[model samples]
Target chain A: MDGTLGEAGEFGLIAELVKIFEGSVDGDEHVLVGPGDDAAVLRIKHGHVVVSTDLMVEGRHFRRDWASASDVGHRAAAQNLSDINAMGGTARHLTIGLAAPADLPVEWALDFARGFAEECKSVGATVVGGDITRADEIVIAVTVIGQCTQSPVLRSGAEAGDVLALVGRQGWAAGGLAVLGRGFRSPRALVEAYRRPEPPYAAGRQAAEAGATSLIDVSDGLLAEARHLAEASGVAIDVRRGAFEIPEPLTAVGAALGADPMQFILGGGDDHALLATFPDVASVPTGWQVVGEVLEGSGVTVDGLAYDGPTGWTHF
Target chain B: MDGTLGEAGEFGLIAELVKIFEGSVDGDEHVLVGPGDDAAVLRIKHGHVVVSTDLMVEGRHFRRDWASASDVGHRAAAQNLSDINAMGGTARHLTIGLAAPADLPVEWALDFARGFAEECKSVGATVVGGDITRADEIVIAVTVIGQCTQSPVLRSGAEAGDVLALVGRQGWAAGGLAVLGRGFRSPRALVEAYRRPEPPYAAGRQAAEAGATSLIDVSDGLLAEARHLAEASGVAIDVRRGAFEIPEPLTAVGAALGADPMQFILGGGDDHALLATFPDVASVPTGWQVVGEVLEGSGVTVDGLAYDGPTGWTHF
Candidate 1:
């Protein structure tokens, strides 16, 4: 059973793997229809739904040598959940579509599912339904469904004079990736951050409640996401260089790779950090640190000047 | 612009393609969240949700030389909706994921979207959300969400002495495939059936209302689906040979290929015909022809004899 999955027929493997999650999340009356059906149905009450989708392909997104099947599962779920959190919503349900070679091991697939379930538990969501098919390579496409009891915090509402804030560690994942690629052993914390991101989930809801106007997750790096906010709000974002702080693990990884720590802090992605624009400092949440300010212009500037460095990750 | 899809970038193509369905459906209040989100949310008042997913890969599922992008789109949406109909539900929403080369043209992607929108209109469903990614080859995965006002007619409730009924044409799509593969020119109807299947949608809902105890779509051929029903219900299904009728177009295609029409009727898949088991003849809906009866054992028999033809389509 721990052998390759491609040997087992696609349908048989799915039937067996589905049994593991049976009765996992019982007693949720809101789930009118659960897994085992074509789709799962959830009852939504007086809330706006927030949805996001991401596709991760083998070689393109993850390397089997660097990450285990469980790592892939955790990262997939975390990325989608982080998107929902960025919009000031709590993730509630997820549906996945997986395509893999015919001869992969069943245990690998199950491990992936376990990782997904564990992450869902952390975020208060459930893996409701999924599809599995045989392909030449592996592909994991996850769609997350979330809901907000209040209005969703959009990326277009940032105003001039708003103070910018950040929650959670930044650039640690990127630094870890560099270390892994360079075959250098980084600090344990840095490697862990790259393997499984821990986003500022609760801080998102808190920021929204605290009257944060616009927000986004730092999955595509700080400069890229800040650019998104600025473009969406038709404003400029100015980062105070001295105000930016790098966690020690990131600095250690940068040192190992002989890379500039500032590059990781400004352009490293997959950190899942929350970046928001608030009207005043008093409106910032507890876990959030002031990093910059929103101004009435286009483009992002570091210390009133352009700090040329890597912008972010490009999917292509 | 109706060319290969890899020519345009993913985001630019999506922004253009989504405009095609801009007001296609009138007064669609059930859609709480539509496209542009991670997942689409639908408002279901008094219905059980039915869901199904299908993955179509290039070469394995379709040949670019044989089918246009629009044809692939229509086929993908049609097959998914047909699955919901088999479960006695009305198709409502669909989430699509498309993986293709980065250089694919934008026009082709938009045409594909238009084709999908056309089929969704036929079944009263909408393309709510989807993911786009770059891959070496083309892969189209569709997940359809459906709803039923009554209890879903499952495939496990058939009892002995129940009549077996079918509501749509069989063997047409399979016959078309054979003809296309053999390079034999055929009538337009046969080719069209293979390109875009039109399943008997309303008849499925009617069968459920008429008290269908067990139901399944003939996606894996008549005999194969009958076997599924028998296995799930712990009973035997006997099909009357004389009652299994073939349309003229299918017969012509079979004649051109010098293939037995019975083979197509018994083993052909993708027609998406609804097959149901009812307690009595009176329970069969109009337009549904009685084709067989349920017996005390497991497995399927044709004309009081076991069918030794092809078993049906296997994914791996």
Candidate 2:
């Protein structure tokens, strides 16, 4: 246990770390099965199950210098949970897979677990089980499970006459990343947005209840995700330029960096905002804004014309 | 679609690959929820579930030079399924988290999926869901779910009078590795053993049915895993030297390498063998051989004497 994870050995380290997360989640009747076996089992109970996964790697998705271990844990879990929300589901449980170098401090790993547990608690989910191994660098892979009491909304249900709406902030994370990359100190608001994305979780369930047809999380830029919905639904989506809402911190950071505020708002990723298309002029739910409308044909248009901007982050 | 997985981009690659395994598993009543959402949902009618996870990384657990993409996929699925087998349960489903560079051949990625699906079919399990992401190296993280009609046989239930048994090949994989490492291409049997491990999956359920007190997978060598069971069960285990029904390939390879055959048998890892302790004196089941006995106190002894061979593989 003194040296890196390799020195402590795989089994030894697992035995030691397993003690911390022992008996964390409450055993409910719905939990026909729990941890410490081959695979967990749960009751679906008259609802559809929602599933999504995300992987965060060192130097790729995150850097140890810019984010604490806890920050990484929170962000990783938040992103996957947001995916579940985008599918119109209520978050329930998560299974995490972690790989790190043996030299990583045990405290950091524990802190990472704490961050995950805290986030799960906020969303009424539990860290059900996970796998840990020694690797060259830290990799946090999370798979989240959710439940939908009604029909689960998908990205292929939108029609040409539907209205497009967004639930939550956008572009702040991209602006914050730019500020960090330039080594410029920024306000707490911008930094916080970059570190921990707070997606509109409850709003998703509400939208599903209110009969939203197509939906997806804005992890990539708004235009990119809009295109996904369009292609999947075989309908074109048109955005109103005046309807692009840029948060104040994002605008300030954009100004400081001499970057286009519209680019950040339209092309910036990792916002975890919920975007959906409704069939009629439905009442916009809380934490949501009317952004545009679904149109005939294919592709995405801004103010009736194609607005050429950065599409999104390309993970290659 | 015309390019490799890396070239196709993450979203595009996933969209293409998802089509293959879209309707693979036979819909079971136990699968209260299936794939294509945030998380899969499975029901446990018997009220008992088992869970385990494993991570396979490039250059660590496998090398592309030594293993075809298909072989890697089979090995990954086999290893996780063996964990369920170790718990004396039947594997039901698996969720995969895969990360590979964008430049990887799309055909290779598809082959990996095919291998995984084939293995699941062999064991009456299904690939329920998964996540795909871009990374510098290939990483395969699998989490398996299993179910049992009765209480799971744990590692802490061995009694001093119980008989210790092993149900599978012992040192074939290690001997195969030695042959491969030394560039001795003569031993085809040994090399195949190294590439693909055939664990006694059904024997696990049989052991559970026949009332096994304690059980564990021989993942990190016989002595090392026996030591784990001894520590967990608070009983000492004694391995009889003459009891080993060693295979001919193991002996032949050991003679050629100028290495101790006993070391390969006792200290070798990754054979996916099963070792358990039972109280009854019934005959050994198929695919199993009686190799040792549980004794009073703790630790493991070989041939009624203290063993000091090479300890199992250490992560640190």
Candidate 3:
């Protein structure tokens, strides 16, 4: 059989993909119906179901020349998983919708599905259902469903006196994108971070358990995410710039290319770190630092004032 | 206020779309944390959650000249909802992902959102969360989460002695496509069917309640779907050609074009009717007609013989 999707045909190609997805379904009684069905059925432990969806376009979200098929798959899964975590929920099932040109290798699609399954496994989730079709370019659309034991941490829950905190590496992915764009593959770690980010998934639940008022995943840059929390919570966020000792990778790459690391830190996005607001500074979890304070106002500020650097990224 | 997405900018355009989506959320207490949050939380009425996802690409699933943006949106939602119905579930929430050229008109995007919301509303569902990004062309991806109290109806459950039944129209959309290609718009019903299919959503629950052993939605032609049920159930489906009194709209259009309505009935895809197998002929629901008998063999047949007609569409 030809390794590419076109030679294998749609039905044959789908059979291979479904076999891979089925391996992740571990007889967990929660999955009443799994892959190869019209739709997937899962037992919802809680009364509430948390849902979120994201799309990754070929040229827009990733570059085939730069990222491997697996990398693209893992990135898509990780980002959606992060969204579920930000809601303070334990992720359950992922339904991924994929579209690629008929000529794409069956091996490529298989590897992509494998990567997606691996990422879901990392967060104790599984691929329950999906749709595959042909398109001019590859499109990965992921929808994640989750259940929460505690009340979901909402962006609108932050109060005026709450302390805003940060968890995990912030600007590593943005910096990695810069290095990859410059065609320098020397810094393997930064490039890897850009390809597959390791978000602190458990920290989100920890924040909620510790009485955090609001939570968000830093997917669209730090400043942009802060603005989201502020706008949703009706409180201004004031970040203490000195508190963030820029990660070593961002600093090293920025200095090597004569580029300012602050741009990546403040404006560049795609690093799935946890940014949360807690009612008390003492209650903030370990490995997370107080980066700012929530104030009664409209927008975000840096260093106790409104310092307007680049606010953030726009996909267009 | 430039009308196009590019002139409006990515963030600005998303704000407009979000405003439209927010109108659908409607302060429903079920939506714990709606649109602005990292993920939306919806109260699940049943113990199980059913998920299905579908993608519509610009040139593949639809053509701009053939379908309006609203029609495209409705078509996308209807197709996904049919998958949920096949599982005997009540549609609950939808999370959509849309990508379009930055230069596309904002009003077009808004119209698309409105149509999507309207479709969700038709089935007592709501739009929960979604992502908007820029691409070379318009792409709509929808994930619907539903709840089912009855056991999920799997195509693999049919027995050899079972009877196959179908509900709702077939071949109307396929015939409509043929007519529209030849530029005949007088038959308004066929044209509209092509644009937006009205699947028999409630009939799925009825089938399940009446003890349907196997189920599927005819998104791909009748012969193709019958083959699917046969393969999954390991029983040959001998469809009775005489049983399906070809819908009136397909008959009207097929005559005008001198095309065999049977070809559209057996091979033309995209009608999205519910097809199920019942243990007894008396168990079939009201609007559904018994179309075939489950036989002790493999693959599909027409009146106890082999069918070599078009096996149906392969997306790739």
Candidate 4:
């Protein structure tokens, strides 16, 4: 049981992974048939289901030395779950497809599952089933199934005169990544942000209830996400620099690195914050901060001017 | 569009991939929102939903030199779609997670998507959405969403009195793989089998409609899958060798390679065949061959004796 996955074999490793989620699966009323079947059967009371998938390759997404197995797992879950949240739906189930080198330790996988299970449990979700295979590098692909309690929100629904609001931290993860890149871990908050993002899970539904016109998750920096909303909705967005109250940690890290903290807020991503356009400021839910406004045009701007900063995360 | 993925960039490549599935998505009645959104919104008319995920890794599960991009794509979709079939559900939606080196040609990705789309179209399913990332090697993870018209058929429902049956070709892919492994490609059919498996997609629903006691897809050879069914159902299965009328192609390949054709029939896999247990031989659906029976015991046997040959494919 303590040996490498190569020794455990695929079936043996799957048994261990299944054992880790046994309690979660058994307790979930929605799951009619869990792991060990050809597929999982789940009762979906909602008429519509929101689905999304995210793939994280070992070195591209996280370095083992920089992030623990548990951190990687939580990060993967957070991103996928955030996609469901972006749709104004509650995350209900997850199916993971994992590929790792045969020499990987069995315990690493189990610990990863523990982290993933804890995250899902926190949001009233569970891992119903998954597949494991051998690969040269570690790759994790998670697909989240969610149910919409109301009409699903879309990025193209924004209209002119809508107020742009944000829920959850922005640029904290980017700041964290910057700090880690500079070889300084003392600013633990930033480093932790880079390790695992904490997306506002409930804010999505709250925004829907509050009559949000358009919605998206800020996996890319605020500017890039604002651009997405603007392009999709056929409207222009204008962000006011003074509207943001920069977090102290980001300020300190920016001072230390001789970089403007505003750049981090404007251009950094991986925070998984909810960005939505409401009919007006009053329609923005409590705990949501208004950072911009929608106008009758296209593209994103900062203080009526185009932002020349780096545009969030890009894979290629 | 004619350049490498690195040249196209993430958004550009995604635009291309989304274009490939545009027609499929537009024609689907179940799709509420398609790609370019944070997540796809799908209407699930069935009371319960069936979900499954599969991962394919380069070199391990496939090789670019051996299989074309389209072949790999078809293989990925086929395996995941078959999982839904095994649950006695109709596959309705798919979410793909693809990771490949940045320098890979964008045309390959487009070709892959085209193959995936064609396969899904054959069964009236569509690619709802997907994610693309950069990795050291190509890794594909596909998750399928399906709808069941009736109660799901689980692998644990087999009884001692049930008759075991199989639909779809078994061991044909295995024979193809063997032929390809030996640096010989004379038998075009066997090589084609390895390139892409043709699963009996309708037989799962047929078996379910005819009242199957238990059901499973033979991704692992028949013997391995039989063991899984037996162990899950707490019943033993007895396979009759004489029941299988070995195909002429397999027989010819076996003769040329000096291997027993029965070995492929019994131990070969990747055929995506549906194996089910029925209350009696009379309940077996058309096109399904009754090859064995469930017995009051544990494990599986061939001709009333333990099968000593290779059990089947092992991932790790």
In model 1 chain A, where is the ten-residue run with the lowest total lDDT? A20-29
Q: Please provide, for model 4 over A1-316, each residue's C-alpha lDDT reduced to its tens digit, 9 standing for 90 to 100.
A: 6989999999899998998777668689999888889999999976589999999988888888888899888888999999999989999999888899999999899888888888888899999989999998999999999999799999999999999999999989999888877778858988898788899999999999999999999997889999999999999999988889999999998899999999999998888999999999888999999999999988889999988878688888
State in Å the error of residue B173, model 1: 1.6
How well does chain B match by TM-score in each candidate?
0.94, 0.94, 0.96, 0.98
lDDT of 3 by residue, A184-284 (tens): 87478888888999999899899989988999999988989999999988899998888888777788998999988877787767779999999888999
Query: What TM-score does each of the candidates earn?
Result: 0.91, 0.91, 0.97, 0.98
Task: Name the regions of candidate 3 deviating beyond 4 angstroms.
Answer: none
Which residue runs does candidate 2 get wrong by more than 4 Å? A1-3, A6-8, A26-49, B1-4, B23-49, B283-286
Candidate 3: residue B304 lDDT (0-100): 76
lDDT of 3 by residue, B70-162 (tens): 998789889988998998888888889988888888888888888888888888788888998887777788999888887889989999999
Q: What lDDT tens digits, residue by residue, belong to model 1 across residues A1-316?
A: 6566666776677676566444444665656656654346565565765666677788877777777788878888899899889878888777777888777778888888888777877877877677777777788877777777766787778999999999998988888788778876567677678888888878778888999999888987898888888987999999887887767776676676678898988998887999999999988879899999999989999888987889787654
Candidate-wise lDDT, in order: 0.78, 0.77, 0.86, 0.91
Per-candidate interface DockQ score: 0.38, 0.45, 0.81, 0.88
- B94-185, model 1: which lDDT tens digit per residue? 77778877766766677678888899988788777777787877777777767777777878889999999988878888887888788864
In model 3, the Cα lDDT at residue A282 comes to: 90
C-alpha RMSD by candidate, in order: 2.8, 2.9, 1.5, 1.2
Name the candidate that leads on lDDT: 4
Which candidate would rank higher by TM-score, 1 or 3? 3
On TM-score, the leading prediction is 4
Question: Which residue pairs of candidate 3 clash?
Answer: A4-A105, A4-A106, A5-A106
